[model samples]
Target: MTQTARRDVDPSTGEAAPPAFESLDPRTGEVVGRHPIHDEADVAAVVREARQAQTAWAELGFAARKQHLDAWRRMLARRLDEIAGLVCAETGKPLDDAKLELVLVIDHLHWAAANAEKVLKRRKVPAGFLMANQAATVEYLPLGVVGVIGPWNYPVFTPMGSLAYALAAGNAVVFKPSELTPGVGAWLARSFAEAVPDHPVLHVVTGYGETGAALCTSGVDKVAFTGSTATGKRVMASCAQSLTPVLVECGGKDALIVDVDADLPAAAEAAVWGAMSNAGQTCIGVERVYVVDAVADRFLELVTERARKLRPGGEPNAHLGPITMASQVDVIRGHIDDALRGGGRAVVGGEHSVRPPFVEPVVLTDVAADSEAITEETFGPTIVVQRVRDADEGVAQANSSRYGLGGTVFSRSRGLELARRLRSGMVSVNSVISFAAVPALPFGGVGDSGFGRIHGADGLREFTRSQAVTRTRFAMPLNPMSFGRSKGTVRRLVRLVRLMRGR
Candidate 1:
């Protein structure tokens, strides 16, 4: 290609500037793909086009939608490796990790498609004795269009939670992927089009925060966002101008609590994997551990030993990949520095462990409850372990955060009880991040973790509106809703109410 053809020309200068922006492979900072820098106008145009496409897509009904979704699933399954390569290239996650995410996403797609009809179809309800002549029914109807702002972490799986459910519920989607992983987003939209070629039922608009803001106000029926808590607030604010409803899955400082009777080896392994996977960029990645004093020493020894063996690199066998967002390395280092300054000791990795694009797993102990590492989301492959006098203190410290997202508890007897007492939206007993793999469960959080669910029945309903219909089967003998009711009828109605009330 010619030099000018490879570059973006400035409209006013009539000279070649540079391509708007590029999606880079985090592992080596190599350009994966180039995309246009879409703005508000661009986002609005796509949303309008999606709105036009939604009419026919919605009319296709549940069975037809399911058929298309199933076709897409088959395509993904058949070409799993190809797509997983794209995921790894753009996000720098291990190939196996990318495949695992796609596997979970496929399961969710099947669940949403198979259950949409049952969950959203019209259902009849018995009318009350006083209104026995009326028939009442309720159903969920599709919103015209939904705009999804997806995060870089688990780009396919995370957004598909919104995308698949929204389409199954009879709505079109206009997605705005994180600029850091636009290639993955574009690949998904392309695959969907191959499954259903008639229209743009799923469209991806690529750019930065500005593009996401535009989507929030693009007149879509609802917005589904997954990102930092601070950015989620901004998205909500932008949607507020147009009075649009939104579902946000934001940041979390998720914790894992270990009881005195817990399985120390299994808990330690889970803690290492949960906290260090994806270079610790996971929204639900474990960031803290509250262990009972009785077994704290053993637990720490096991976790530290496993954590030290992990290394972040571009190799195929590497346990973790580079940090997808380059800027986040600084944030991770800052949290580590703060933890150390607050009198915490790093048992595994420390300040010297963080290098550009990679951060070794760092385990801190004795971190104060008020320390930034404990209070705020570090979003790195770092875990802080604290010794608690008992399970009560462990639970109390775990619930002290403003974030109430996903958490884990390891206990033989008190797992369920302690899980119920924890303040998070979802928790796993003796397992780490297992709740996200189950397609039947609703996934979301409260407090700083954000609100509204994105999986299971609630997720399907999030993209639709509930509609109630009441029809008069016959004229009532005592019609309270009629203006032509006689005094005798009113007197009888009062008598019936009084008799029912035992007056």
Candidate 2:
């Protein structure tokens, strides 16, 4: 590729842009790759082609779509390792984590392709007693085209939760990958294009926020966004101007709870992994921990040991990878400073390297429940651990945040009950965010965490609309409001409603 090809620019505004942006190896400051993307018109052309292709693809029956999806899934499985390597290079996640994410992505793709027809097939519905002559059957139909605004963290796995389902439901997809990981996005589109070879069913656009805004404003049927709540609100506002519907999987201030009867070792292990994995860039990463007052000290000791053992930088074999975005270092440092000033003690690794991308894991204890470290989504390898009066307080503390994303709970007997009580989209009982591994469960959140689900049956239905059709069989003996309506019929309807409602 020429030097001009290795550049990044927002095609919408036509402003001078970065020819190349460097992706550093988190373990070392060495450059991983210099990536570039197509401009605004280029992105628009891709979307236009996808729109034309969707018309023909949608005409095909569900069986044809399923056949294509199966072929794509087989191709992806065969090349999973190649995709994982691209993910690792772009997002700086550990090799194993990248592979794990790919596995889940494949599973979701399989589930969506196999189950869309079942979940979305038309079914007979009662048209109400008043309209007994009218028959109703509701079936889900594709939405023509879908726009996916994805995040840098879990680039492939998270977005595919939406992308795969959208395609399986017969919608052409236009994706804008996070600026930090554009390569993976391009790779995904390229792979799918090869599998189909007939149409531009999967297209990608690369650039900064303006490119993303362009996708939201483009005449797509709906937008599926996965990013911070602050940015999600912007995407929603952009789509609102066009009267377009959007699904946001926004940021989360997720918490982990350790009860008095909890296994201290297991809880601590979960805490360390939940906090520091992917340098704590995960949306559902445990930002705060609430432990029973009785076991708080013991839990802290165990967590600190685990936190210290985790190293963020080395080579491919490193436990943690460096922070991919340069801007996050300051944010992570600010949270640590605020926690220390708020009377929180550094029980583990509070001090970061003060170097380039690599951020050390920091575990703080005695943090005020209302402190920024405890209340906010840090999005780094830092954790705030606090003590609670009991399980009730733990549940309350966890629900206090505006975000209702995924969380974890550890208890001996009441684990399941407490897990359900906490207001979150998904919960892992006695485990650390294991729901992402279970393809049967639905993922996504409510409130500031954003709406619309991904994964399972709900995920498959998100990309389609309900198409209701009524096929009249035999006319009812009593025709409503036709030539046979009378004043006595109206009175009887009111009496029936009152009787049914026990008025």
> Which numbered prediction scores highest in lDDT against the true structure?
1
The deviation in Å at residue 455 for candidate 1 is 0.9
| Pairs that clash in candidate 2 | 7-19, 11-40
The local distance difference test score of each candidate is 0.91, 0.84
Q: Which stretches of candidate 2 lie above 4 Å from their native place?
A: 1-36, 495-503
TM-score of 1: 0.95
Clash number for each model: 0, 2
* Candidate 2, 192-301: lDDT as tens digits: 88898886789888877878988887789999999988999999999999899999999899989899899999999999999888889999899989999999889998
